[model samples]
Target: MPASHSSYDSGDEPRPRHVAIIMDGNGRWARARGLPRVAGHRQGVEAVRRTIKAAGEAGVEVLTLYSFSSENWRRPRAEVDELMGLLRRYLKSEIADLHGRNIRFRMIGERDGLAADILTLIDEAERMTGSNDAMTLVLALNYGGRQDIARAARNIAESVHRGLLRPEAVDDELFSSYLSTAGLPDPDLLIRTSGEKRISNFLLWQCAYAEMVFIDKFWPDFDADDLAAAMDEFAGRERRFGSTANGR
Candidate 1:
């Protein structure tokens, strides 16, 4: 099928190079099945595997997943410990497979907040996969978009104070260079699984024009076909980017 344009004109279909996702509803999925919440998290890991493979297959250059939010620490200590343990297990089990696929793995968030062992594993993963060229897999663990922006602002201020950068020269592009995702391209598409309609503090500044896709399927159940459907939907969008469809 040809692409759809809700605006004035349509031309070639758009292809998203980078995609970000907010994986939600694991607890709900577990509760619905009368299973423990940890079970839901385990299932979510499977979903992450499927989604990353799908993104790679679809020719997406970058994929960012909100694995754990900073606010997640407020949950019960047992759950927190379980989540961290699962993260370590995933890194240990998946790093070899991910390397085989030539995918670069990276994580963002406050390293100080992570357990020492987990932090070591995360650093090792990045170093091992740093040279891979196929695709980049970014995991936003213990991340919060607002916090990210705040940190960027703080960096920018420090630079200005040090006379490295003039406050007057700070534009969007300049400011973006101070962000954690400094060298990365903005996400072209943003997906939220488990039917959550809100962004929930994922990629706040970086996803300004990203085409949003919300899928009803729980994280564990969303697979390649679901990602393809989202891509198809994205390919049919018209990105104005402050200009008309016909390039006014």
Candidate 2:
């Protein structure tokens, strides 16, 4: 276990402002129950709803979910189609509710490959919730960390070529501004369900210093308690950010 923050003053122990989750194991969860994988994916949506509510209650400012990864496109066409349909339905049904709750809905990923209708729905959701400040729910759809980085680099190169930016002005801060998550705080805590210890090409740049917690439960089975437990574990860590314990 890491050092606990309990000994510090309440003001000294700040809760994470941003959290990212890798929702995994949906297929396995369905297989275990002798059901179709889509069944687990559907249950995962419910889990997502539960998590959003839980996160709000827990004072999280931003919640980023790995809804669909770039590699997921390689899955069976039927499964991919089902996932896309789920995303479309979720956007249509939840955007209004999210706005009513004062939660901003944002999607981060490559948008060109998505269906035209899905893109339109995404645009509407973002426009509707753009002014909300209660919290942000960022869905990482068709996203990949490496690809994000590559895209940023490409953008920077193009800018430099066009004489819009000097090569000397390029740095970490400038580079990050080009990412899909620009203007958002980096995640302080990252949680991966299904007990997977790897990052799986998610948030490679943004989560550089995040405290990671891996849970054995499948994503569909995750609940508020699970999130609470992970947070409790996070509260026990001392983030030095490359500095020593003595703050040297």
Candidate 3:
């Protein structure tokens, strides 16, 4: 889509092509409830389940969740292990049902620190759901927008040096093709929970023109209704995409 003529700008689509979410405030939610942070994380997983179904129902082709970031590793080792354990359990048990529902699963980010079994499970899930066309659910685990850009830059430079690509050929589309989300459309809507107003380095390049919505509620409290309301808000606005009010 043209920057000046996106689906929203043209009013051609009922909803966004892709919705990206920064699932924040799990620890704070747990702290407020006087419960362990893992409890909130578990509940956040449930929110993910609801959002997946809701996004699919809302006709969103792709849904991306900022499940974990590179900075997340700075946390205590115990918490990290627990989070990894939760991820393991989710993958071990959820893949079959997700496949049956025809929802394709995709994970972006470096897999360097992940366990062998987890990597195997992720590969299997992708292969099994690769053919599904109903919807796509992307999980950004251990992902960093800066790191992604840097990686792509290194690869592009190498390609140029090897005579496989020309430096003059580098452009927005070409750079995007080098990223992890090479084939996926750029997110049209970005949501951050717990009243966070920052993008937090998520989708730094892809969200250049995305409409952002911040929710006051924590990740665990988000539901289908919240998703619907966000879309309604998006629908009411006129996306100019850097154009003037008349889109000239």
TM-score for each predicted model, relative to the true structure: 0.93, 0.94, 0.94
Q: How far is candidate 3 from the true structure (C-alpha RMSD, Å)?
A: 5.0
What value of lDDT does candidate 1 attain over all alpha carbons? Answer: 0.87
Against the unseen true structure, what C-alpha lDDT does each candidate score?
A: 0.87, 0.92, 0.90
Q: Candidate 2 residues 1-248, lDDT tens each?
A: 12342322243545788989999999999999999999999999999999998888777899999999999999999999999999999999999999999999999999878999999999999999999999999999999999999999999999999999999999999999999999999999999999889999899999999999999999999998887778877888999987899797
Q: Give residue 5's error in model 3 in angstroms.
A: 26
**Model 3 residue 78 lDDT?**
88
Per-residue CA lDDT of model 1 for 107-207, tens digit only, reads 98777688889999998999999999899999999898999999999988888899998889999998888878878899999999889799998889998
Candidate 3: tens digits of C-alpha lDDT, residues 8-112: 434465678999999998999999999999999999999998999888777789999998899999999989999999999999888899899899999999899
**lDDT (0-100) at residue 19 of candidate 1?**
89
- Indicate the worst ten consecutive residues by lDDT in candidate 1: 1-10
lDDT of 1 at 221: 81
Error of 3 at 83 (Å): 0.6
Best by lDDT: 2
C-alpha RMSD in Å of predicted model 1 compared with the true structure: 4.2
How good is model 2 by TM-score? 0.94
